[model samples]
Target: MYSIVDIETTGNGIKGNRITEISIFKTNGYEVIDEFTSLVNPECEIPYFITGLTGIDNDMVRNAPKLDEIAHKILEITADTIFVAHSVNFDYNVIKNEFQQIGLDFVRKKLCTVRLSRKLIPGYNSYSLGKLCSAIGIPLKDRHRARGDAHATMLLFHKLLRTPNADKVFKSFLNAKSQEATLPPSLPKAEFEKLPTTPGVYYFKDSKGKIIYVGKAINIKKRVLSHFYDKSTKEVTLCSETSYLDYEETGSELIALLQESAEIKRHYPKFNRAQKRQVQQYAIFSYEDRNGILHLAFNKLKMAPNPLHIFYSITECRLFLESLCETFELCPKYCHLQENVESCSHYKIKQCIGICSDLSYTKEYNERVVTAIESLEETKTDYVIKTKGRTIDEEAFVLTRRNIYVGYGFVSKETSLTHLDDFENYLIRQQSTLEAQRILESFIRKKEPKILKFTAETTR
Candidate 1:
């Protein structure tokens, strides 16, 4: 049995948002068994944008039951039945968060009709409820609201059940169940319904609830679907043995990367590729003299907190620092690249800035050194680094602050530190690893990103 559900919420997020309306249809095979529907008092204003989409407003739901008032009825109707929904995660998470607020833990197996439809009926251009139904002859009476969409999805699911390959499709659906042998099991339809489309990390666990694999993706829903996109030998084997999937949403790709790194270290899932336990080895140091003249050198090191640029290995660290030194015209002797010579080897070749032997104003060369240092100090302040967004084909940005790796978030332009406090509150402190630092440095070297100054600075 399945309790196919859909909900319209005040916002997309689960933490602070509220549901405005909901619909549930309990089904057995192709027939409806029971139904429940409500317009909820979300306890907040619904944005004008959302109001236009769902035709639900604060005034309309002001007198309606708070989620707490009707949550028990929902549980009773949905009890012992699998949950089903379109683009399931939004619906599932919104409901779960609401139940959680009421001191109740609402857990259930879920199945996504979108996934089932993709496997059973391929070649549709869009999997969205309206588009899929339109392309496949399933009429949609309502586009964005709950009851209209839920009823339409139920009909589409019913049609899938009537196909010749229905048994195989159902079998795949069953296998999607997180806990196949658990007691009082709800249908597997709910879990699939709640998976989000945002970039984040996901965990896959086996029957005994041991995490087997952890992964990050630009699009969590698409990535999870891709694993089941085709039943290759590898996926087929993994699918039959898999029992549960869980995920944490990271607002930006940089945050995703940081969280993925931390999680991989913490869980050490069986299928994960082991990361190096040792700290990075590349060292950036200089050979200097009593006259305050400096020369740069690169080497692999077993020590900490010594500097020119630190990397994981001698080769990468050397190549990177060498390129910078060459670009900035620093002398070899000042960088500690050579010994006992009054003039750098580069001086003979005209590659050096001649600061070693030339009695040019000390102030000018020192200015260049300062500029170079400033150029290398990428994490010293707040800035946005642009790249391909979550969709890979679109553009996005990763935000940072004060030589610290703050969490990444998205905005169309280099958003100002108009609200640094917001950024500070949300920033996830990540390890300043050589790889991540280099990635930021490379971008800054080329674009010299516009720094957005904020009066206030805080750490996340």
Candidate 2:
């Protein structure tokens, strides 16, 4: 038994949405055994746009029965039946939420005519109720009304029941383990199933093969599945338009982060918002205190005079400063990590060396501060960072020329790479980006990287 259901809502989304009108057709496979249709007073003013699309105005449902008044009838009619609808999740979730608000539980085994039609009927330009019905010659009347759409969905479901191999398809979709009911109607199961559970960057593409969003994950399959389950409006819309998926596995998470940023910039995917915003620039600078202690600190680029090193985010600035503090054996308090404190008791930096307590020589500390600042302004030498590759037999290396990121490449472990010039043959060159720099610096700050130096003569 299946109850074909549809509802016109006062709002577009599941949460806080109230049903303005509802229609249900109780069917035993081939024929309708019972039916129910009613206008519902949602107890809220319907938005102008919703009224425009649905044609159900405040006047129409003003005197109609409230949902709580007819809740018992709904429960009785849908009892012992599987719920069916076009783009079923919307209708099913809206109704389920309505029931919950009235202190009732509505749970039913669900089926989507759109998903089923795509699987059983095969090639069609669209699976939306109106388009699919018109394409198949199903007479659809009173376009957006609950009864009209629900009736059409029932007829479509009847055709799907008779299509070849539909029994098997229906069985698979009904299985408790199936994600068929959760995925967007336009996306194919195969596209999602092929995703690898490895570290990588994934792309969500529309039907026309344009990249719409890019993301990196330690487990690509798990992360992509999370998007499907998200109920946020933006996430739901992005998933609805995603008809395909593409990915590239980078064994190292650091490499994945770099590649993900590069792809986002190159494609400028519409759904990628975080990387599109302008990055804030920070600079490390030095100053002398009342006690003649040379302190290293960071500020916004415009505020810092004679800046030592620039970074994209405050995190990068702090990380670079912390590294200098630990290396120079300088006081964290003097470095401005802990402001206005009498002495340094930093949790991360315990290498104060008594400078905060005035035991160390001011001249010696000033000299080390000079050395740290000079290191920051020194010219970047050509180098290579080697890490794990996509496959076991290969290794990956990121190249830089004079401290500017060149690109990354993979090489066979059997091939000996002695210098930065040796990686040129395998180099897949890329443009330097602020995001890439931040990611690289963060990785270097935490990990002891395999840094290989190259001289000019080696390349010649």
TM-score of each: 0.45, 0.76
TM-score between model 2 and native = 0.76
After superposing candidate 2 on the true structure, give the runs of residues whose Cα lies further than 4 Å from its correct spot: 278-382, 447-460
**Error in Å for residue 356 of model 2:** 38
Q: Per-prediction count of colliding residue pairs?
A: 29, 0
Candidate 2, residue 116: Cα displacement in angstroms equals: 1.0
Model 2: per-residue lDDT, tens digit, 85-166?
8878778878888888889999999998888988898889988889989999999998899999999999999999999998
Could you give candidate 1's per-residue lDDT for residues 211-318 as a string of tens digits? 777778888978876665433434433543455678987655555666676677667776666552545576766544566555456666655335645567666775
What's the lDDT for residue 92 in model 1? 68
* TM-score of structure candidate 1: 0.45
Give, for candidate 2, the lowest lDDT window spanning 10 residues. 351-360
> Relative to the true structure, how large is the alpha-carbon lDDT of every model?
0.68, 0.87
Candidate 1 has an lDDT of 0.68
